[model samples]
Target: MMTNPTKMERRRALQDSLNDRINFIKSVEEIFNCHMVNFITGNLWDKHIPEPIKEEVAQLGEEKVLELIYHFGSCNSKLEVKMELTAPCPTLSKYLIACRQYYYDMTDPSINDEESIRSEILNDSSTSVSDADDNIKKRNLSSQYLTPAKKRHEVDVMSSFIAKMYEKKLANQGIIGAIVDIGGGKGYLGSALALRYGLRVLGIDVASDVTDAAKSRNDKICRKLSEKCSFYQQKTVFVTPNTDLGNLVKEFQFLWGSVTRVALVGLHTCGNLGASNIELFAATKTTDVPVTILCNVGCCYNLLDEKYLPEGVIDKAHYCLPPLLHGHSVDLPLDETSGFPMSDFLCQRQFWLGRNARNLASQSVERVMSQKKVAVDALFHRAVLQTVLLDYAENCSDTVQKKLLSKLDEMMVVGKGVGRVYKRNASLNLHEYLKTAFEKLDLDIQLPVEEVDKLSERYDCFKSKIKIFYLIRIFLAPVIESIILLDRLLYLLEKGINEAYLVRLFDPLISPRCFALVALK
Candidate 1:
């Protein structure tokens, strides 16, 4: 029988695995940049599409490309390559194989293995609570709120895990104290922790409106439980940017009454706020008030400050690491003020991914694949509209062209909002929608019916090319997403915080941005 690895050995193994994956992503940064540049700048319907992509599409033919897209969409995993091809297009088949392999290779094994990580953390040990306590928690959960079922599941799992971590710290450090909820809008999770665990909670947020809402929510909960919990409207930005860490902790201690231990938590803390929480937790250890644990689940990657980027990525144009390393980077030495080289190993190279790419990273592959038909229809609408606008602009005056472009922008926004309606309403005509969009613009000039017909014909001719471009973009999605999640994980690890873990906390189908970065000291 094989011996199980020690905790230290497992940690080293996980780190090594992450480093190897990071290196792999770095190697392919140029290729990803090339693909993104073509997608961003090249016209899909024209000869402006990248030469390599055009050649592959030509080799596969329109029928084959469509077949492959449909086939890939229905399957759960890329490993399901046994589906027989409609046409013997060796070039396209090879390319499809490569795309699947690239996706699986880039994905971190740890993300899908949430159970294993939880097991490792809990050491396969179960904590016993009285029947009364369990019943109270269940009652509070059912009575408490308007959150979706999936969100409730996430909060339940996360809160229980955090409570356990807090108990473990209490046993070790001989300090039992409050849980601090960062960006605690409406105080859902914080209130739950207070009711279920009997732990004092402090919920903080910058938005006064939301903070007010949270206070109202707490009032309702307190009425139900016959107990009060602390919730505050504090500006973390002010605390992080202008104040001294030691002084801030002292201030919190004074207000909260000798808070010697704290468990910092946030659910989907956006952008730099998540990073700020990590910094605050680390800083607390330096002060008399020590933060024993932290559990932060971050979202909105596009909003993260550029300064927090791995040092190597700061200057590069196509800076975003591939999906595998998305939010995490390899360990790099830290600078006290700037948190430079967020990943230690990433200091050797530079890369950049734009806001569009980061937003793309938040998408769920499973959901996208399942909803492929709807997604493709939306893309088709956009592509056809683009062609129509271009043709209309060709014969028009500069003033007319500018007006047409403005109308096109409005139509794009409307299309996104009503995509499902368009899909379901078979009577809704695309040509009619375009005409209505133009009419709504209330331009002085009118587009003739003949012109609309001509534009529709042109779109039909270029439809195949647009579909192929969409497929290629979809294929690259997972790769981009992986890099972002990994980068976030690396940021914590690079700071010498070893207990950090990246977990898929919610169902991706229900919540696309479901990954959570969990840590404890």
Candidate 2:
């Protein structure tokens, strides 16, 4: 990963980086393009995986496959990656190595090397006494502000990276005095920047309630560190393509603030927020507070819009969502187009990764091993539940029937929504999963033992097979993520932002969405 985005010919860099990845993606395109819920929930004993990879998994069995998974864990202290496991399952093993090797130049956390997540310059000796003081003070933030230890690790990295850039921005242009923190939550990033770097910050959140909460939190923090903390403010606005950020904050007050120059930044921005920030950065030609730079870290690949999955495509994901969220994915607006394929290169290639694939891309083999649980059960539940949903559709009214699959016709129907019935991180017992899910779907309380048994039989002999099937999908996670992130970098490059760059900004185990996209004008 290029930590110092100071010097580089970005155009050639992006082109060179993109070429092989394009080839890699083309070769493995079918793996990610399939509807995974449909595929994984199918007969893993027979289909749902490539024959070569399937044979490889069958030969290696479950324990070896799991050991290989443990080799990828990083960023979490509790999880130690087993160094250099033998390549027993050649097909999947090679895929894992290739994925990690591909990551080497980006984040440097390959399976052969376990300590790559430790930053080279993280504890760099600073001549600035204030910098040293601030670093020491930051250690107390987790205890003081109720931030998680893992979260503090993320904040430290981002703070260091952004502060270095901000200093250069100040020394050269001397214009940017504040950052526009997009998708900021309760001004955490703002607090860090202001506390350590003496930078002014304006935290903008899409949620009004959060913005209000931020004000209260900021007031408390400000009073505690009144002398050191100069300025941090919060605002609530749904920043859109048409949003004029300069004008939005023009009337806003700042104690130690200037609108002459500003940077648009977001840390682990969920879904479209990251995309929207980048778009805002590009679109803004503001006279009020000129956004001279941008830095964004995006998560939730599944939350991203699918370019081809039309706006009206039934959001079969959220069954119990309120009426306000009925027509959309969540609180955010859905566009017919997506934030993906941002570069002309990818757009021209007609590249597409469906919802299941995107969700799969969000999976971390590292986290999977660290936690020691494959979402095999959750996925199993969802898949078997898909059949129930299909069966239930037969009883619904004509209007309701039109929205779902009429039969178990596996032509193109997506398995959606039943996962919504269960808690995201809950380890579900099969009985509980059935009871709760059945009740949620308005099915009979009496357990459908026979139907469930028939479905269970499809996967009973293939638990190892199912785990291995998931391993490969999880292995492909970072590769596809790298492609998506690189696409964003390429997008900036195509836009002629020569200073545009990507960095491995967070520890992958602590925070899976570690790559950040940055640019300066």
Candidate 3:
């Protein structure tokens, strides 16, 4: 018999576990830093960002550039370091604040009452005399810029933050790529991303109404984007809507060539759409595309069965889920509609069990406790009770039955007082007996000995793998969303397109939102 752990022991264990995880994260950060520094020191920026953006990034001196890189690395590693090199700050939010201060110093001289602009620049420099002095200077700067100057500073900082990521690539070329938005309802997110990053977007969805809506929305966006880009060199925003993705992918590959990036921008692509994207990423090719990054925020995982795809393509091995085992011969099951093959006996068993549980609960609740009074709505318990009354009422304890009767007596009085004395044939003891039966039935059915043994063997082998996969699924929303992110990351890895200088505009931790995928390359 194992004893439960003490609170202090559990706490200590948790702390130690956290320390280990943090150390692992630190190692990853160091490895990434070493690789990025070696890569970035070369002409990585030259190949990636624009010349003007490069000049702006160059404005930050060597030490300052390293500081920015370090900050970026920390951010990438999910660390909360905010103070500049001049100060070892404690707070995480302070970093954003410091960046805002850096921008304020750049744009608004009125607020920063330094003796000279040169002095202010020097104070903002990495070579600032002391942390105390820098803090004092920053305080003075903050005191001066109270209103409109502060707003301008914020925008400048944000733009600069975004610009740094694209500094190397944006300078060299206009976006020489296409972004395919899967199930992009009105194509707002994709359209916005394209407009922001200077990429052409193609929104794909099965619904013609949504496609038509996206077309209308894109037309308006084009007019606005055209006006915005008119001052700069010409860049067009094209929106292709209402294309049936079932067969159009091959046609698109033939026409515009394969897009470099595919974005599933949360228009709620359900079951089949996700499975299709996985297939597309594995197969689709384009002339311009070296490899493609897929960014999806998917919903409705339950729907992505064998029926969601074209007939005769999906391999037996590339199952959306794993297959099952049997006594005789393991055979693949065909879908109800498609008559296509799928093999997942375990999954079917699980689904059946869930359905049975719900049905049994409903039926059981209806029986012993006639819908007479409003009391404890213990549906599950009631189901068990009905099962017991039919099967195992003889084994029930008299003490348990008496305990239930007491509640029934009180309910009867209350029911009469409320002008609704609905009487039923079943007594409180019977209800309690039924509840006991239900509990017993659950234990009997849910963890059958053979199933438990099979599960145990699998668990012993793949416990860690199972934990990681479950964590990824549980902590993240809809399966499609995780799939989309993983697809993009895999695409990046496969294409050798690793030097992604990207900024997460939406803070994931704070807002519980995901950042949009913007590929500068």
Per-residue alpha-carbon lDDT of candidate 1 for residues 327-356, written as tens digits (9 for 90 to 100): 322223333443222444444454345434
Question: Ranking by lDDT, best first?
Answer: 2, 1, 3
Full ranking by TM-score: 2, 1, 3
Worst 10 residues of 1 by lDDT: 127-136
Clashes of 1: 29
lDDT winner between candidates 2 and 3: 2
Model 2: per-residue Cα lDDT over 1-521, one tens digit each:
53433223444555566677667756765555554445433444354466776676667767876777556533232323334454566666566666665655553221111122122222343222124233323423433574787777777778767776666665346564577898888777877777666667789987999998877886787677554444677788778867877775565544553467677889889876777777777774647667777889998887777554444433233232223322323222456647776778777766666565677678776677667777677766665665455555656666555444322222233433454756766677666787898676544545566766776787466555556656666667777787778777767767766556566666677888877787778
Cα lDDT for residue 215, candidate 1: 80
Model 3's lDDT to the true fold?
0.32
lDDT of 3 at 231: 12
TM-score to true structure, per model: 0.72, 0.77, 0.31
Q: Please report the TM-score between candidate 1 and the true structure.
A: 0.72
> Could you tally the backbone clashes for each prediction?
29, 0, 21
Residues 1-521, candidate 3: write the lDDT tens digits: 53434434433432333233234323322211111111211222344333443453345434453344344323332345444542432221232333223222211222111223223223343332212122211111121211354333332232222222222233234433444556666655444444444444556666777777766665665564453321111112221222223233334444445434332223334544643443344344443343233333333433334433323322121111112211111223444532111112212322111111111211211111122222322322232222223222224355544433332222221211112112355434323433344353332323344543553453243222222211111211211122223333323323333322112232233222222233322
Clashing pairs in 2: none
Model 2 alpha-carbon drift over 4 Å, by segment: 1-13, 34-41, 72-88, 107-143, 171-176, 224-230, 241-254, 257-259, 284-289, 306-337, 387-416, 420-429, 448-458
Q: Candidate 3: deviation at residue 91, Å?
A: 34
